[model samples]
Target: MYMLRKFRKVFSLIILTTMMSLGITAPGYAAMLGTDDILAGDNLQQQRDYVKELLNRDEVQNQLADMGVDPLEAEQRVDAMTEQEIQTLSSQLEELPAGASALGLLAFVLVVLLITDLLNLTNVYNI
Candidate 1:
Protein backbone atom coordinates (compact mmCIF):
# COMPACT_ATOMS: atom_id res chain seq x y z
CA MET A 1 0.00 0.00 0.00
CA TYR A 2 2.83 2.44 0.84
CA MET A 3 4.65 1.63 -2.38
CA LEU A 4 1.45 2.17 -4.41
CA ARG A 5 0.86 5.49 -2.74
CA LYS A 6 4.46 6.59 -3.45
CA PHE A 7 4.12 5.58 -7.10
CA ARG A 8 0.91 7.60 -7.46
CA LYS A 9 2.54 10.68 -5.92
CA VAL A 10 5.51 10.37 -8.28
CA PHE A 11 3.21 9.92 -11.24
CA SER A 12 1.19 12.99 -10.31
CA LEU A 13 4.32 15.00 -9.78
CA ILE A 14 5.67 13.93 -13.14
CA ILE A 15 2.41 14.90 -14.84
CA LEU A 16 2.39 18.34 -13.17
CA THR A 17 6.01 18.96 -14.09
CA THR A 18 5.37 17.95 -17.68
CA MET A 19 2.38 20.27 -17.88
CA MET A 20 4.37 23.18 -16.48
CA SER A 21 7.31 22.52 -18.80
CA LEU A 22 5.06 22.38 -21.81
CA GLY A 23 3.14 25.52 -20.71
CA ILE A 24 -0.12 23.65 -21.06
CA THR A 25 -3.23 25.57 -20.05
CA ALA A 26 -6.92 25.02 -20.35
CA PRO A 27 -8.85 27.06 -22.86
CA GLY A 28 -10.48 30.21 -21.47
CA TYR A 29 -13.67 29.54 -23.40
CA ALA A 30 -15.34 26.43 -24.82
CA ALA A 31 -15.17 25.89 -28.55
CA MET A 32 -18.40 26.30 -30.45
CA LEU A 33 -19.36 24.49 -33.68
CA GLY A 34 -21.02 26.68 -36.27
CA THR A 35 -23.73 25.40 -38.58
CA ASP A 36 -21.42 25.70 -41.58
CA ASP A 37 -18.69 23.83 -39.76
CA ILE A 38 -21.09 21.06 -38.76
CA LEU A 39 -22.41 20.74 -42.33
CA ALA A 40 -18.96 20.95 -43.86
CA GLY A 41 -17.68 18.15 -41.61
CA ASP A 42 -20.09 15.66 -43.23
CA ASN A 43 -18.57 13.79 -46.22
CA LEU A 44 -20.18 13.16 -49.60
CA GLN A 45 -20.04 9.38 -49.21
CA GLN A 46 -22.13 9.50 -46.02
CA GLN A 47 -24.80 11.45 -47.90
CA ARG A 48 -24.67 8.92 -50.72
CA ASP A 49 -25.04 6.04 -48.28
CA TYR A 50 -28.03 7.70 -46.59
CA VAL A 51 -29.70 8.16 -49.97
CA LYS A 52 -28.90 4.54 -50.90
CA GLU A 53 -30.42 3.24 -47.65
CA LEU A 54 -33.58 5.27 -48.27
CA LEU A 55 -33.87 3.87 -51.78
CA ASN A 56 -33.40 0.32 -50.53
CA ARG A 57 -36.54 0.44 -48.37
CA ASP A 58 -39.23 -2.11 -49.39
CA GLU A 59 -41.91 0.51 -49.92
CA VAL A 60 -39.56 2.57 -52.07
CA GLN A 61 -38.61 -0.49 -54.10
CA ASN A 62 -42.29 -1.39 -54.62
CA GLN A 63 -43.06 2.15 -55.67
CA LEU A 64 -40.17 2.10 -58.11
CA ALA A 65 -41.51 -1.12 -59.61
CA ASP A 66 -45.01 0.34 -59.83
CA MET A 67 -43.52 3.27 -61.73
CA GLY A 68 -42.02 0.76 -64.21
CA VAL A 69 -38.50 1.32 -62.86
CA ASP A 70 -36.36 -1.67 -62.00
CA PRO A 71 -35.02 -1.51 -58.46
CA LEU A 72 -31.55 -2.35 -59.68
CA GLU A 73 -31.76 0.34 -62.33
CA ALA A 74 -32.87 2.82 -59.70
CA GLU A 75 -29.83 1.93 -57.61
CA GLN A 76 -27.62 2.48 -60.61
CA ARG A 77 -29.31 5.83 -61.21
CA VAL A 78 -28.72 6.84 -57.60
CA ASP A 79 -25.05 6.01 -58.04
CA ALA A 80 -25.03 8.02 -61.27
CA MET A 81 -26.46 11.12 -59.58
CA THR A 82 -24.02 13.89 -58.61
CA GLU A 83 -23.10 14.54 -55.00
CA GLN A 84 -25.41 17.54 -55.01
CA GLU A 85 -28.34 15.40 -56.10
CA ILE A 86 -27.67 12.89 -53.36
CA GLN A 87 -27.51 15.68 -50.79
CA THR A 88 -30.76 17.13 -52.08
CA LEU A 89 -32.57 13.82 -51.96
CA SER A 90 -31.21 12.97 -48.52
CA SER A 91 -32.26 16.37 -47.19
CA GLN A 92 -35.71 16.00 -48.69
CA LEU A 93 -36.12 12.54 -47.20
CA GLU A 94 -35.06 13.83 -43.81
CA GLU A 95 -37.69 16.54 -44.01
CA LEU A 96 -40.55 14.17 -44.82
CA PRO A 97 -43.03 13.11 -42.09
CA ALA A 98 -42.91 9.39 -41.37
CA GLY A 99 -45.87 7.32 -42.65
CA ALA A 100 -47.36 10.46 -44.19
CA SER A 101 -47.03 9.36 -47.80
CA ALA A 102 -49.96 9.02 -50.20
CA LEU A 103 -49.19 5.32 -50.68
CA GLY A 104 -49.11 4.81 -46.91
CA LEU A 105 -52.47 6.53 -46.50
CA LEU A 106 -53.97 4.41 -49.28
CA ALA A 107 -52.74 1.21 -47.63
CA PHE A 108 -54.10 2.31 -44.26
CA VAL A 109 -57.50 3.06 -45.76
CA LEU A 110 -57.60 -0.28 -47.56
CA VAL A 111 -56.73 -2.16 -44.36
CA VAL A 112 -59.37 -0.32 -42.36
CA LEU A 113 -61.99 -0.97 -45.01
CA LEU A 114 -61.13 -4.67 -45.17
CA ILE A 115 -61.17 -5.00 -41.37
CA THR A 116 -64.59 -3.31 -41.14
CA ASP A 117 -66.00 -5.50 -43.91
CA LEU A 118 -64.67 -8.66 -42.21
CA LEU A 119 -66.29 -7.71 -38.89
CA ASN A 120 -69.60 -6.85 -40.63
CA LEU A 121 -69.36 -3.40 -39.11
CA THR A 122 -69.63 -1.71 -42.49
CA ASN A 123 -71.56 -2.65 -45.66
CA VAL A 124 -69.47 -0.30 -47.80
CA TYR A 125 -68.03 -3.21 -49.82
CA ASN A 126 -71.10 -5.54 -49.38
CA ILE A 127 -68.63 -8.39 -48.79
Candidate 2:
Protein backbone atom coordinates (compact mmCIF):
# COMPACT_ATOMS: atom_id res chain seq x y z
CA MET A 1 0.00 0.00 0.00
CA TYR A 2 2.87 2.42 0.78
CA MET A 3 4.60 1.58 -2.53
CA LEU A 4 1.39 2.26 -4.43
CA ARG A 5 1.01 5.69 -2.78
CA LYS A 6 4.61 6.60 -3.51
CA PHE A 7 4.21 5.59 -7.16
CA ARG A 8 1.09 7.72 -7.47
CA LYS A 9 2.85 10.74 -5.97
CA VAL A 10 5.88 10.35 -8.22
CA PHE A 11 3.69 9.81 -11.32
CA SER A 12 1.64 12.88 -10.54
CA LEU A 13 4.77 14.97 -10.00
CA ILE A 14 6.23 13.80 -13.32
CA ILE A 15 3.04 14.63 -15.19
CA LEU A 16 2.79 18.09 -13.62
CA THR A 17 6.45 18.82 -14.37
CA THR A 18 6.09 17.64 -17.96
CA MET A 19 2.98 19.74 -18.49
CA MET A 20 4.61 22.82 -17.02
CA SER A 21 7.79 22.39 -19.00
CA LEU A 22 5.94 21.85 -22.26
CA GLY A 23 3.64 24.83 -21.65
CA ILE A 24 0.59 22.77 -22.46
CA THR A 25 -1.94 25.39 -21.56
CA ALA A 26 -4.54 27.22 -23.50
CA PRO A 27 -4.44 31.03 -23.44
CA GLY A 28 -7.68 32.94 -23.26
CA TYR A 29 -8.73 36.55 -23.75
CA ALA A 30 -11.94 38.23 -22.66
CA ALA A 31 -13.34 41.69 -23.33
CA MET A 32 -16.61 43.38 -22.62
CA LEU A 33 -18.44 44.12 -25.87
CA GLY A 34 -20.11 47.51 -26.27
CA THR A 35 -23.60 47.83 -27.72
CA ASP A 36 -22.26 49.41 -30.90
CA ASP A 37 -19.75 46.62 -31.41
CA ILE A 38 -22.41 43.96 -30.96
CA LEU A 39 -24.89 45.77 -33.12
CA ALA A 40 -22.28 46.34 -35.81
CA GLY A 41 -21.59 42.64 -36.07
CA ASP A 42 -25.31 41.92 -36.47
CA ASN A 43 -25.62 44.71 -39.03
CA LEU A 44 -22.70 43.39 -40.99
CA GLN A 45 -24.29 39.98 -41.20
CA GLN A 46 -27.57 41.51 -42.30
CA GLN A 47 -25.78 43.49 -45.00
CA ARG A 48 -24.03 40.39 -46.27
CA ASP A 49 -27.31 38.47 -46.29
CA TYR A 50 -29.04 41.28 -48.13
CA VAL A 51 -26.34 41.40 -50.81
CA LYS A 52 -26.43 37.64 -51.18
CA GLU A 53 -30.20 37.69 -51.50
CA LEU A 54 -29.93 40.27 -54.26
CA LEU A 55 -27.36 38.17 -56.06
CA ASN A 56 -29.56 35.09 -55.76
CA ARG A 57 -32.50 36.70 -57.46
CA ASP A 58 -33.35 35.17 -60.84
CA GLU A 59 -33.03 38.49 -62.68
CA VAL A 60 -29.63 39.22 -61.19
CA GLN A 61 -28.48 35.69 -61.88
CA ASN A 62 -29.63 35.94 -65.46
CA GLN A 63 -27.88 39.28 -65.93
CA LEU A 64 -24.67 37.85 -64.51
CA ALA A 65 -24.89 34.87 -66.83
CA ASP A 66 -25.41 37.13 -69.81
CA MET A 67 -22.34 39.11 -68.81
CA GLY A 68 -20.30 35.87 -68.63
CA VAL A 69 -19.95 36.14 -64.85
CA ASP A 70 -20.94 33.03 -62.98
CA PRO A 71 -23.49 33.88 -60.30
CA LEU A 72 -21.88 31.46 -57.86
CA GLU A 73 -18.47 33.05 -58.42
CA ALA A 74 -19.94 36.52 -57.82
CA GLU A 75 -21.48 35.31 -54.56
CA GLN A 76 -18.10 33.93 -53.51
CA ARG A 77 -16.44 37.25 -54.30
CA VAL A 78 -18.97 39.08 -52.14
CA ASP A 79 -18.18 36.68 -49.30
CA ALA A 80 -14.51 37.52 -49.63
CA MET A 81 -15.09 41.28 -49.49
CA THR A 82 -13.77 43.18 -46.49
CA GLU A 83 -16.08 44.82 -43.98
CA GLN A 84 -15.39 48.25 -45.43
CA GLU A 85 -16.22 47.10 -48.93
CA ILE A 86 -19.47 45.56 -47.77
CA GLN A 87 -20.39 48.69 -45.86
CA THR A 88 -19.70 50.82 -48.91
CA LEU A 89 -21.77 48.60 -51.15
CA SER A 90 -24.60 48.44 -48.67
CA SER A 91 -24.63 52.19 -48.29
CA GLN A 92 -24.68 52.67 -52.05
CA LEU A 93 -27.56 50.23 -52.32
CA GLU A 94 -29.49 52.20 -49.75
CA GLU A 95 -28.90 55.40 -51.70
CA LEU A 96 -30.59 54.12 -54.83
CA PRO A 97 -33.73 55.96 -55.89
CA ALA A 98 -36.99 54.23 -55.07
CA GLY A 99 -37.86 54.11 -58.78
CA ALA A 100 -34.47 52.79 -59.86
CA SER A 101 -34.71 50.14 -62.53
CA ALA A 102 -33.46 46.58 -62.03
CA LEU A 103 -30.98 47.25 -64.82
CA GLY A 104 -29.35 50.01 -62.75
CA LEU A 105 -28.92 47.68 -59.79
CA LEU A 106 -27.52 44.94 -62.01
CA ALA A 107 -25.09 47.40 -63.59
CA PHE A 108 -23.91 48.54 -60.20
CA VAL A 109 -23.22 44.99 -59.08
CA LEU A 110 -21.38 44.19 -62.30
CA VAL A 111 -19.22 47.28 -61.93
CA VAL A 112 -18.29 46.33 -58.38
CA LEU A 113 -17.42 42.80 -59.47
CA LEU A 114 -15.35 44.10 -62.38
CA ILE A 115 -13.39 46.39 -60.09
CA THR A 116 -12.65 43.53 -57.75
CA ASP A 117 -11.51 41.38 -60.64
CA LEU A 118 -9.20 44.14 -61.87
CA LEU A 119 -7.78 44.54 -58.39
CA ASN A 120 -6.96 40.81 -58.42
CA LEU A 121 -9.07 40.27 -55.31
CA THR A 122 -11.20 37.84 -57.27
CA ASN A 123 -10.82 35.67 -60.38
CA VAL A 124 -14.49 35.53 -61.31
CA TYR A 125 -13.93 37.26 -64.61
CA ASN A 126 -11.30 36.39 -67.21
CA ILE A 127 -10.63 40.09 -67.80
Q: lDDT tens string, model 2, 1-127?
A: 9999999999999999998989876789999999999999999999998888877888878988898888888888789888998998878877888756356668877888789879887666677
TM-score of each: 0.46, 0.76
- For TM-score, the strongest prediction is 2
Candidate 1 TM-score, C-alpha based: 0.46
lDDT of 1 by residue, 7-115 (tens): 9999999999998989966769878999887776476678777766766778867876675556675566557656666676666666667775435423433454456
Off by over 4 Å in 2: 1-16, 19-27, 99-101
> Which one wins on lDDT?
2
Q: Please give the lDDT score at residue 40 for candidate 1.
A: 61
Where does the lowest 10-residue lDDT sum fall in candidate 2?
96-105
For residue 4, give model 1's deviation from the true position in Å: 86
